[model samples]
Target: MTLRILILLGALSAFGPLAIDLYLPAFPALAQAFGTDIEHVQLTLAAYFVGLAIGQLIYGPLIDRFGRRGPLLIGVVLFSLSSLACALVPDLDWMVAARFIQALGGCVGMVAARTVVRDLCDPTTTAKVFSQLVLVMGVAPILAPVLGGVLLAAFGWPSMFIVLALFGSVCGLAVWRWLPETYPADMPRRPLGGALANYGRLLRDSSFVGNALAGGFAMGGMFAYIAGSPFVYIELYEVSTQHYAWLFGLNAAGFILLAQVNAALMRLRGPQFWLMRWVWVHFASGMALLAVALAQPAALWPLLLPLFCSIASLGCIMPNATACALARHGANAGSASALLGSLQFSIAAVTSAMVGALHDGSSVPLAGVIAVCALLALALTVWTASRD
Candidate 1:
């Protein structure tokens, strides 16, 4: 049963990254296709993030009110249709809009999967399962770009969208055919009023906000990497896009491996202890990386080493921080999971956009954003821990 849930959760979580990364190699092709600049091509990514952030919030309430199956099935249907539209679009504006809708649809799988996990398990189990899910997510970004490059090379930018559409359809069918409704009958049934009340209570709890923010900043630190990596690797080091895919995959593997370590630790110590330690790990890794980046003589080795350490930091923080947040509202899993997931992506999108806006195509901007985010996250984690 845990394996079944893990597979479904992984597939659902992978949707967001797969949707973005699978088409990344086509950035130049897309810019050319629409007669736009590179910056405009990046807007497509930002728009998708915005849609994902908003969609998770909406899906949470609907799932709680109507049950997971209905809202989830509807989301996959919309996701598939929007993906088809993305493939067929004639211009960049059309592509961006379609991508937004696709993200909106795709986020349902993620929100539902998290809510479902909370419904079925206790906090310890939630952290462990979420660790396994991250392993699967780590795979998508690793392989998607390679696959995207091949698709773009053989056919065109649109072909990648076709592949993604097919992926969504397969996932949708799996959910409809096999996934069970996990909401228990005895669990407190909540409508909008009840959901609002729960949210109010969670908002008043500092530990919930603090832990969620720790994870949120970890995400923001990651965005600094995402916004800057292509330039740092491809432009500065002159690595080929195909090679960059492999490089990117290696970093993701680091995330996967470390998350498993967190899962193993959870079997003994509390999630809070692991989360507090990881927050410091994240802060130290970021500062070390930033120091090396700023002291650079423009060597590739200096960049990759610290960057991997910085990414590995998340492997420790993400699952534990999330476990703490969702642990607070076990009774209202769907709504709580929704707000938690929504806040994560919303902060991520905003931070990623900030990195984009402050971009000068240099390593400093990326490292600076990471340091600030990590430091703030560490402080909040400490504060959250002491009170708890």
Candidate 2:
């Protein structure tokens, strides 16, 4: 991929993290504005996740049938319009509805970005490209919260949505001007039934299923950390919100740094080799985290160290797993990308829920959930290796 294409894909892939992180600092203000509690406000986030999962399935076949650019442009329009609605919403229910719409539209970029990469690159290059994309996308988590807080203080929480609207609009423009249709025009279009059949076939492929699920479980562990970290840091560890933001960013930084390193090093060793290496690192770190939680250490560094490692391991895991999974499905790249993305979020939804449900005012729930996800991921990786 050219630098231009890489940048565009990176921007596209960054949508989810940006959307999720940018509004986080405004949660308290949102609760107050809607005359509701934090739990009610959280429904909007849940609604977004639901939309992302379902929307990918909806877009997969559409993009495959009609091609990537048209469906993608429509999705961008939907996202922009819904973001505007979110900014204008008068009630919490309206906000929730709008957020769901936003995610439904925004997730097109996620599906299409991966599809585009598969359309353009061979498997090895695909992994390297994805790693580079991570470097671009990874900036969102580090910057969005601080940026959102600044926007909230200066212009109010609604300003954040307005910014998102602008961001979507710019993305749409970029797609229109520069992004060529990567899906081969001469390729026969699939009917909806055909698309569904493709999904079924994908599931039946042991290598595809194994790599996809392994990636999903690894991603689940990351989301588990994101969900549980606030309480674990602020309440249990007695870290202030200000300090907690820094801590979160530190972990994000680790991820970004390792992703760049992986991009460079994978060329020498291959993505699969490093992928399995990091899988072990991921599982070990999770076990270390569990041990730290169980020990109830007086200092927070022990827990933080393993937690950072667990998150950082994804720097290698995701790109490799994705490259491997979609490698054989270039004919149905859109559908393949959609299923890969949807499965990831599905696993993430489960693991995040586990953290919450298992919460006992300690780090154990968070650590245990991460460990379980790691174990599942490790098993899946082994299964994938055996199948190969």
Which residue pairs clash in candidate 2?
A: none
**Shift of residue 181 alpha carbon in model 1, Å:** 0.6
- What C-alpha lDDT does candidate 1 achieve relative to the native structure? 0.82
> TM-score, each model?
0.96, 0.94
Runs of candidate 2 with Cα error greater than 4 angstroms are 32-40, 297-299
Estimate, for each residue in 1-388, the C-alpha lDDT of model 1 and write its tens digit. Answer: 4576678778988888899788877776887889986667777887888898888878877888888888898998899899989999988888889989998999998888888888877889889888888887778988988898889889988888888888889988989888888877876557865766767777788878888888888887886677567666776677788887888888888989999998899888978889888888788888987887778646687767778888887988999898899897867777777777777777777776776687776677778888888998898888888888
Give the Cα error of residue 249 in candidate 1, in Å: 0.3
Identify the candidate with maximal TM-score.
Answer: 1
lDDT of 2 by residue, 32-78 (tens): 89998544566677677778888898999998988999999999999
Estimate every model's Cα lDDT from 0 to 1: 0.82, 0.86
Q: List the residue pairs that clash in candidate 1.
A: none
Q: Relative to the unseen true structure, what is the Cα RMSD of model 1? A: 1.6
Badly placed stretches (over 4 Å) of model 1 are: 193-195
Q: After superposition, how far is residue 285 of candidate 1 from its true place, in Å?
A: 1.6
How much does candidate 1 score in TM-score?
0.96
